[model samples]
Target: MTVPFYMCCQYVDGKFCFVLHEWCAKLPLKVQHHVVHPAHTFFLLPKIPSKFFGVFNCNICKLPSNGFAYGCTMCGIYVDINCAFIPKEITHDAHPNHLLSKVKPLVKLTKRNCKACNYPMRFRWGYDCTSCDFYIHLDCALFLPRVTKHKCDEHTLSLRYEPAENHISEYFCEVCEDEFSPWKWFYHCTRCAQSMHTTCVPLILQCEKSRMTYDSGGVYNFLNVKFGGTLEIKGHSHHLTFVQGLESDGRCIKRRYVLELSMIFKCLEFALMDQIDHFDHHHPPSLVHLQQPSNKSEEDDDEDEEKDEDADNFVEEEHHGGKCNMCNEQIWSFHLSYYHCESCL
Candidate 1:
């Protein structure tokens, strides 16, 4: 798929000129009360601290960072610079009565969850109201885009926290027809009264016109080009230079977001994978996911609630080769990525 032309970078003379993404350039040099260690101030660091073990983990996004970050060494909290922009307080539609404050992980034992969605606060990342006792995962928070338009509705759909009180029994998603929870956030057209899930809001079908289908046959990872560096891919003949998403660069957002959203449904993917080390592999094997083709289109492309099941079924279908001693999965590694022993992989 084509990179949003805006990401091509303005005021740049060359493709590898070490320019920052437009969104990256706008981040404040210093931030406070908005990251992992909210009380401490986070400074934009050019390099990760040496005190961190072999790999530096961002407590905010729960992702590893080899590039730029906002860090608070005092409390040992480093965050992916992109996620640091998340506001400490946000007004979400799911609860219109109170502005939900951001919830983060604490050092000691803490118990919390999203009252809606039934997902627990594993990363301890969410937006919540203490007195009202409301909580929602950061994954849900990311879906709350203020406004969007789709072909299903004749007019623009405005995001609403709750459905109309005067609604009929048919207050369900126009796209999926699943009955929506009254307190759950959704998109609605005032003129048509049609409602849709916030996660189902990608009407810009640019891929159809371009004749591109996002599958599991692409190099997928969190591309960190915020500082403009080069990385040599394993077994590749040459060193690969980092570019922040380019149209011709061959990296797809469908791969990036699908893998990212897996954390929403299955928090166990990385939480258990990262801490363990195999005898053959020094680094944790990265998890990658490509969006499946839905009836219409994408942001993470397709698979959402069904991702966990689809992935399990894919692994079960692999019987072409001998199994790895580590996990007993088929020894196949071409385009698809799986968490397995590097030597066997």
Candidate 2:
């Protein structure tokens, strides 16, 4: 048998206290016989502070904020409800030219790699090209702009690359803020004691192309950049040899680090399903898939044989084995990147 709950109330001075119902009469405390049953046992809790219920958004991830919140509401400041707060400005010696910027949602629908992570920048909120697709997380892109002159003797370093070399770095690039000795086709500034990875140079280019610039030395700098092969890599000196046809491992490292090749193939499948979207706007609508060979391949050894088999299997499955999920047309592996049909995407 369970006991019913009741609440009790007390009255003072002169008149007898009143019980609203029989349940109140049976409460725990019977002060001056005023106690009611389960009703009297109820406890009253103190009111809580309203400030404890404020909100914020995650500074790193940009999720909804919670907990003891304090921010500029007028500027839409917020953070995740349960995350710890971080400082806005970071100080470093390597990047003395400018302070780092904190941001998120660097790019959208990009099938490329991130210069910092050496992986695909997909579905992540991190530091990014304010104007273009280049992106980096706060923790990753953190660097102190160089202040003093570099220790190297060959070049008189400047914060900016010289125009004579076509905007290319004059010395070695320091990856992960490592010590620089000798490297080619890399950017360096002896005067500023600064160096950057060759891959990082592309980031500057993309920023320039997008016409995006941030405050550099109290001036609102623009992305006015040009590129020429002037610097040389220490280990891989041949990097500067084949200008246009350089087989860069950076691309491979990027895909391998982030999304697997299977995902790329999956994206290809999605592309085939929606080939029309990838088509040139000027060209007449022809049900053809434009094939752009992938830059890197994981299964290089079996790629040739597996591709043929996959093509056959795709044809059999799409044409008769299974329905095209996009437009209900029959498709096969041969029709992987480009699917032909009215009903397909």
Candidate 3:
């Protein structure tokens, strides 16, 4: 990762000169600063490394770059690089009917406040726009529901800007499996009067992706929670099943999902470990095992004793060991299970 450049000021030719610096290595050079009047803005002059100079005013902040320069992509709207990568879209449950878009300068559009959030889409990066004009904060936009499904519920829930008089007022989320008020952004089962929290929807979407490998009925919801049922994708022979489980009511389904995600992570961990082992042949297996995830639970009664023994074994084994090809740590066993530190790896 590159360290951020900083702005600095120095007195030169009886005047304070602004400049961009690498944040370290004190160096200053004299140069002309770009100052756009009418706009009353200041900018750094473009120069190659060979002709580099010191302190210059940042055209964006009206202050020095603390010694570094940042180029803005938005047509001369320069800002520090740190502030450049804002999210473009957000779908918030607070305003279900709309997906929010960030405000863009130089674009003319009528602004409207969110009926649900009472937040103006024109202000603070939130604005309501038609095909003609659109703007809203990224977080505010997330409230809209992109899709709906029924699972262990009754009334059908659809994403709407406002609720109807006869609409079901409360239901449980099939994803988090939690009960919530229907007024909130949620998944509603029209048949059973069921609903799901807005936050639960994204997690449920992940389960859908993973379901592609399983067949209907073959993938059980352990907790007897109902689903929208299985799906048969085009170009595939097998059916896929998924269950949205709310906590408190769908314990079995929750556990199944957790187990599945944990297994996936474990597989990734092993792949990483294998790569490390191949690169460092001389590292002892025991040291590598220390870096690997523990199969035994932390609550195991023997954990403390095992840890003490392992430490003792490591020290003794290193007493007359060959140097590790990676870290300087002593080799403990010939079955090298080298674990790479995240930074080094």
- Among these predicted structures, which one has the highest lDDT? 1
Q: Which parts of model 1 are misplaced by more than 4 Å? A: 1-58, 61-78, 85-99, 106-112, 138-143, 151-154, 164-183, 203-345
lDDT of 2 by residue, 1-345 (tens): 145543345654553343233443333321121111122222211111232223233344332322333232333433321122334444333333455444434355266443433444454443444354544443333321322233333464333323223543344344334332231223556455556533343332221211111101111111111122233445542333211111111122333332211111111112222334322133233344434466766676456666666554554443325554434665544554443444432
For model 2 the local lDDT of residue 216 reads 14
Sort every candidate by TM-score, greatest first: 1, 3, 2
Question: How far out, in Å, is residue 17 in model 3?
Answer: 48
Tens-digit lDDT track of model 1 for 160-249: 655565564666667645565545566788888788655444423322111111111011122232323445545645544432232222
TM-score, candidate 2, is 0.21
- The predictions' CA RMSDs to the true structure, in order, are 15.4, 25.3, 22.8
Superior candidate under lDDT, 1 versus 3: 1
| Candidate 1 lDDT score at position 329 | 49
Q: How does each model score on TM-score?
A: 0.42, 0.21, 0.26
Question: lDDT of each structure?
Answer: 0.53, 0.34, 0.38
